[model samples]
Target: MACCDDTCAPFDGASPAYRRALLAVIAINATMFATEVAAGLGASSRALLADALDFAGDAATYTITLWAIGRPLRTRATAALLKGLSLALMALWVLATTAWQVVVQGMPRAEVMGVIGLLALAANLASVLILVRWKDGDANVRSVWLCSRNDAIGNVAVIAAAGGVWVTARAWPDLVVAAAMAGLFLTSSVKIISQAAAELRAAAAAA
Candidate 1:
């Protein structure tokens, strides 16, 4: 089977070093996922939930990358499109959840929002650093990079919201950040999906 063969060397299907790096991202992302979820619930913070879901999305993105690393070009392109779609769904979900909390019920715990946000930002930053070196490796690698980069930007917004919360003692700032994060996800989703679709079409033509 292909899995049994060494042809698909893991981590962007490149050298052992790249495989190691990707593996690290996978492990770290998994841990962060659990951490953020628990913290979000404990804090009852929409911002924390946003971070948690963001990490979840990153985990899914990397999982897709690992699965497509050594596949054919057309397969890789299709995988990227699917990954993008998944991201879009996640964004929609987050937006819906945050909107309900903000407009109907109310904002979540502000203190927890800021604290958990900072913690999640640190974790995501580490993930970004880990994947930065492999950003240009392949479509699979680029997808992972885009996911990480988008997440880092979201984290920054979260951090800023935390500061705003500390000062204003309001939920608007947190809601705003959560909405912005969702927007980023939606934007990235479109770009990745379009690129993947074009690549897949080209591959089919070439075949």
Candidate 2:
């Protein structure tokens, strides 16, 4: 909105370093997506599934980020909108799955929670390290970085929840973490959608 000044520089998108970082993080997240999905099913853990969907949404976010780099403001806004929609969809999926697990599945398979959660945490931490340098980037790039950062945070929470479940032999902690992750997504979706809407309106006015 401010004519793409220094604040929007990293969003210039064509920078090789930025593209490299995005690709690396995407690869990491995509792999984790599959891993968590499988682990979720094996453990019957709703939190794991929610985290898996988060990873999936991040993969799309990174893809859009890479595409929006150096592109027009309108293009960036469109990408943001798409990512926002993805986040909402993933949140819904998590909510439905978690509710079902709570009502029907009983306690999840404890063994898989700790093992898969630790693996996911390690991978997410690596992703954070890769994207930390660009955290202060433009709105588009910052959005992508935020997704990565949130994922890392969620990963830690999932790991801790797994540990807590193991100690307490209860399913509530896992469900709580999953619900928190849903709440995080809900908030992020609103922010991203609002930004994208503003940008689109501005672009339309200019056109």
Among these predictions, the greatest lDDT belongs to: 2
Worst 10 residues of 2 by lDDT: 1-10
Model 1 C-alpha lDDT per residue in residues 1-207, reported as the tens digit of each score: 001011112344466787677678778767877886676667545666666666665665566666676679887777778767876786788788788877665646666666666776677678767766666547546555555566666667777877887788777777777777666667767777788889988998999
Superposition TM-score, candidate 1 onto the true structure: 0.75
TM-scores of all candidate predictions against the true structure: 0.75, 0.81
* Residue 98 CA displacement from its true place in model 1, Å: 1.7
Question: Which whole-number lDDT from 0 to 100 does residue 75 have in model 1?
Answer: 78
Cα lDDT of candidate 1 equals 0.66
Best candidate per TM-score, number? 2
TM match of model 2 to true structure: 0.81
